[model samples]
Target: MCLKRGRTLLQYAISPAVWLGVWQLASMAVGMDLLLPSPMAVAASLWKLAGTPQFWLSALFTLGRVCQGVLGGVALGSALALLTHFTVWGERIFAPAIRVMRATPVVSFILLVYLWVDRATIPAVVAGLMVLPILWGNLTVGLESVDRQLLELARAYRFGRWKTLRLIYLPSLRTHFASGLLNAFGLAWKSGVAAEVICPPALAIGSRIQQAKVALETPELFAWTLVIVALSLGLEGILRRVVHPREERGQ
Candidate 1:
C-alpha cells in the first residue's frame, strides 16, 4: 500500500514537470516571445502580476462571481427540483424551462442577460444559469429516489418537518447533492470567466486576459492563463478536501 501511494505521489510530481518541459521546448521552437512566451517568461510575468493590487482585486471579484453563481444555482435548482418532484403543475411548468436552458447556447443566454443586467453582474448570472440545469436534474432524481418508508418512519416518530428533512431527506439526497457540487463549481467558473471575457468587467481575470490579448502581451497572457488554471484547481481541491477529507487522508 505504501509503495502504491509513493508511486502515485511520484506520478503527480513528475507529470507537471514533464508538461512544463514540453511547453518550454515548444516555446523555444517558436523562437518569438510575442508568438509563444517561454515558461520562464510566463513565470516572471506571473511574479509581476502578484505585485499588483489590481491582480488581487480581479482574482477576488472573479472568485466572488463564481461562488455567488454556484450558491444561487444550488439553492434555485434544489427548490425547482422539489417543486417538480412533488407536483404535476410544477413538472409541467419547469420541465420546459429546464429543457430550454439545456438546449440554448450559453452565448445566447449571456447576450440576452446582458440586455437585462449590468455588465458587472453578467458573469455571475451566466455562471448560475449554466449550473442550474445540472443541479435541478440531479436533485430531481435524488428527490424521486428518496425512500418513502424512511419518511413514513419519521412521521411515525413524531419528527417535526424540519427534523424529517434534516434527518431523512437530506441524508437520502446527499449522493446526488454531492454530485451536483462536484461538477457545478467547474461549470460556474468556466461560464463566469467566459461571460467576463465577452463583457469585460471592471475587475476580472477574464478582463485581464482580454486586455493582454489586445496588447499582444504574450507572456502576461500566458501567466494570466496559468493563474486562472491554478485558481480553478485550488477551488476544486479545497472542495474535495472539505467533502472527502477522510478518504483523502486515507489514500
Candidate 2:
C-alpha cells in the first residue's frame, strides 16, 4: 500500500514538473516577462504577496462570498426541486423561469445584477445565480430517479414522513446531491471571481487581479491567478473529503 501511494504521489509530481519545465522553456524563448513570466518569477511574486496582510484579507473576503453563494444556491435549489417535484402548480410557475435562467449567459446576469446591487454584493449574488440552475436541474432529476420500490416499501412499513426521508430518500439522493454540490461549488467560485473582476469589489482577490492587470504587472497577475487556482483546488479537495470521507480513508 505504501509503495502504491508513493507511486501515485510521484505520478502527480511528474505531471506538474513536466508542465512547469515546458512553461519555463517557453518563457525563456519569449524573453519578455510582459508576455509570459517564468515560473520562478511568478513564484517569487506569490511569495511576496503571501507576506502581505492585504492578500490574506482579499482571499478571506472572496472565500466568504463564494461559500455564502454556494450554500444559498444549494438551499434554494433543493427547496425548488422539492416544490416542483411535489406540485404541478409549482412546476408550472417556476420551471420556465428556471429554464430561462439556465439558458441566459452568466455575463448577462453579472452585468444586470451589477446594475441592481452594490458592487461588493455582486459577486455573491452572481455566484448564486450561476449555481441555482445547475443544482435545481440536477436535484430535480435526482428526485425523479428515486426508486419507486423503496418508496413503496417505506409506505408498506407505515414509515412516517421523517423516517421515509431519512432511510429512503436521502440515501438514494446522496450521490446526485454530492455531485451537484461539487459542480455547483466550482461554478460559484469562478462566477464570483468573474463578478468581482467586472465590478471591482473593495477587497477581493479578483480586485487585486484587476489591479495587477491594469498596472501591467504580468508576474503579479500570474501570481494572483496561481493563488486563485490553488484556492479553488484546496477548497474542492476539502469538499471532496467532506463528501466522501470513507473513500478518502480507503474504506
* lDDT of the candidates, in the order given: 0.90, 0.92
Per-model TM-score versus the true fold: 0.92, 0.95
How well does candidate 1 score on lDDT at residue 113?
A: 96
Weakest lDDT window of 10 consecutive positions for candidate 1? 239-248
Determine which window of 10 residues in candidate 2 has minimal summed lDDT. 164-173
Q: Evaluate model 1: give its TM-score.
A: 0.92
Candidate 2 root-mean-square deviation in Å: 1.5
**Per-residue lDDT for 215-235 in model 2, tens only?**
999999999999899999999
lDDT of 1: 0.90
Top-scoring candidate (lDDT): 2
How many residue pairs clash in all the candidates, one count each?
Answer: 0, 0
Task: Report clash pairs, candidate 1.
Answer: none
> Could you tell me how far off, in angstroms, the CA of residue 104 lies in candidate 2 after the best superposition?
1.4
Tens digit per residue, CA lDDT, model 1, 86-135: 79999999978897997888899889999999999999999988888989
**Cα-based lDDT at residue 216, candidate 2:** 96
